[model samples]
Target: MKKLLIVSLGIIGVILVLSPWILILFGRNQLHDHDIPQQEQLVDDREKHLILAIFPHPDDEVTVSGTLMKLKEEGHEIQMVCLTRGEKGKSSGIEDEVELAKLRTVEMKNAAELIGADHLHLLDYPDSGLEKVGLDSLKKIVGELIAEVDPDVLISYDSKVGLYGHPDHRLTGRAVEEVFLEKRGMDGFTPQEMFQVTLCKKQIKIALKLSSSFQKNYPEDPKQGLPRPDFSINTRKFFPRTLQVMQAHQTQQEVLKDLMPFHDKVPTWIYSRIFDREYFREVK
Candidate 1:
């Protein structure tokens, strides 16, 4: 009787442990269900320029890569600034921060290359320790990088970075905002008014609407308990390229495959865009 009781208890424990993952899988299917929508925007004739993306980790780029890929296809120079090496991710057989960071870096570079991006700058900050980094110091580093890249448009984590709410994402956002102010150049600025290419309320609202459907489908997502975001990018034109790029991150394949299984079911050219408001600050 005692042995049978022990077996029953073990099964219960296993179920409890796997409950979160099961719930997440269900939510993922819902999140990946939609076909990308088409969004039409009048393009202004201007000299081609760069769009800079600042992210806290390697995979963070995947969340917004669709828009970046679209912009690149449209001929905008794309660059990325990653803040950490993602050493904190657990390894089943491999363990060691130094080695893990190096491995992750290689993976990140490959992912970037797949998207035709040639410029990538890593800040070498400690993973999960971004909040501890002084705001002033972070601002200085990101500010200098921004000045060097000088992209026409910028993208990064939303104020409420999905699910994980990593501190690194918050700090990166703050640093980007500060850098914008410093570079606004009231005294030494060239633009005269402020940072150019700020996203307007209309654009932000459209993005937010797209994100609402994602949140509504995944109300049980522990990583993000919040409602839909207030901004999103129109992504139909670049969905295929984005999925291809996402598949390049082999280490994250299991999770990505489970969550983003649209590759087999959806049309390759389906339109879908990511949205975030944190990167939508007004420079002017």
Candidate 2:
């Protein structure tokens, strides 16, 4: 019994040490397993266009940074509106809410600049409290921004997944959807397209299987349906720039740093295979 216990402990240690690599391999395989659909690149004759992305917090922009960069490269303007400063987010150190919110604001500004966004609007809503916010009030605030931007393209989270069921994410997504639908028939307010940032259901399933830590943080919920992307943007060319944008969020590094392995530690082909695409479901 003593010998068996010793061997079990050793195996557990080894598994823990190798977990990251195992997850990477699993992710790579999962990408190959899916027959991902791609759409023809968008072409617009307009000399200048505006894209407005509404998200819940500071780091949420990273979810679509690569796609945003591609849009900017195509001579379109990109703007971001974060509903909160992430005051309730986990701190890397001993920072209080006020200190953390201030830090995140600067980090977001830097990230926006790196992504070549034309503007960023930071709405100082209370973090972790969006669910409690009045729907009409949230819609009014977002509606005002939509009116000001008159964006040609709009982006936000998918209310279905919210990529792990974060309440703020779901709330923000709902608000954006409401504003988009409400303004569609209004004169001069119809956006050409609206998309929700999302992950493939297969990818999420594989991630849950490979990382015990991820599973612990985001338990598998059969009821939490996934979004089926209407089209996927090939962002392989801009993946490096995307990483740069993510790195700019300095205070969020502890959470973001793990993403580096997809760029650095993995083979270039593997990195491209797994992360060179950003998924989006078009809102009709």
Candidate 3:
């Protein structure tokens, strides 16, 4: 009994000594901007502009929903486009693709309504088969959409890595970025800036633990963590709206809960501490 007690005490002492070192080494968040008060100077409160986001799936816009709400409150128009209704994805063991497609479209619309998106465009594109649609064709369609919207700001995922290396997401982001490049300096019009959604190294590490989708899709390169965000949007002021947006996509509850297991079960403030910051890399 005494030997066991000594061993336990020694283990506790080692943990206590290594606690700060462990946190310092492993718990360091890879965000480029630390504790930005509310928002970046990129957005001016006085000027009204249109913000547009294009994603492959219904729930993808949740990434920037808080920023959308903030922009809306400041009198900016928000428009979200989903290239696919996420029919190819599984949710809650639902296997009927056609049924899930319709259901997801409805959920997307509901979330768009809650986001106060002035326009919610749901396009029917093959979900997981975006690559099959081919890049040039996708670019033509995306370019036209951008031309029509004529947004001041554009949003999409990281083209190279697509956050966690989702193939559809990569295609969507590549299409958006390529279109933006083509339209830039055109005679017509183009967005002043484009921002790509990204998760930091630490965030992806946490996500791998929670979501099997991420674990499977994430690159096997041990060194290839998600890019460090160029800046962080402090969305703490509008976390309530963010939570509502998260809840709007009931079909994606598993994905949301993976990030925060007790998200809605606990007080909103508790989760806001981790989620209040939205990360992005500005597209040049």
Highest-scoring model, lDDT? 3
Report the C-alpha lDDT of model 2 over 1-284, residue by residue, as the tens digit. 99999999999999988876676677656663356676434336356678899998999999888888888898888999999998877647735999899989998999999899999999899998987887788888888888888888889987665765677887788788877877787787857778998777666666566544346545356666557677678887887777778777777776664434345566665465467688788888
Which parts of model 1 have CA positions greater than 4 angstroms off? 1-45, 91-93, 160-164, 181-231, 254-284
Candidate 2: which stretches are off by over 4 Å?
1-28, 40-48, 210-223, 257-264, 267-270
Q: Which consecutive 10 residues in model 2 have the weakest lDDT in total?
A: 257-266
Q: Least accurate stretch of 10 residues (summed lDDT) in model 3?
A: 24-33
Report backbone clashes per prediction.
Answer: 12, 0, 0
lDDT of 2: 0.77
Model 1 C-alpha lDDT per residue in residues 39-93, reported as the tens digit of each score: 3321221656677878878766776676666667777778988888988865323
Instruction: Please list the C-alpha lDDT of all candidates, in the order they appear.
Output: 0.58, 0.77, 0.79
- Best candidate (score: TM-score): 3
RMSD of each: 12.9, 8.3, 6.3
Query: For model 3, which pairs clash?
Result: none
Candidates by lDDT, descending order:
3, 2, 1
CA lDDT for candidate 3: 0.79
**lDDT tens readout by residue for model 3, 1-284:** 99999999999999988765554343234322344333554477787888889999988888888788878888898999999989876865789999889989998998899889999989999988899999999898888888888898899987887877788888889899988876788777668888898876667767788777788888888566466677778777778877777787777788777654566765565456556678888888
For all predicted structures, in order, the TM-scores are: 0.63, 0.82, 0.84
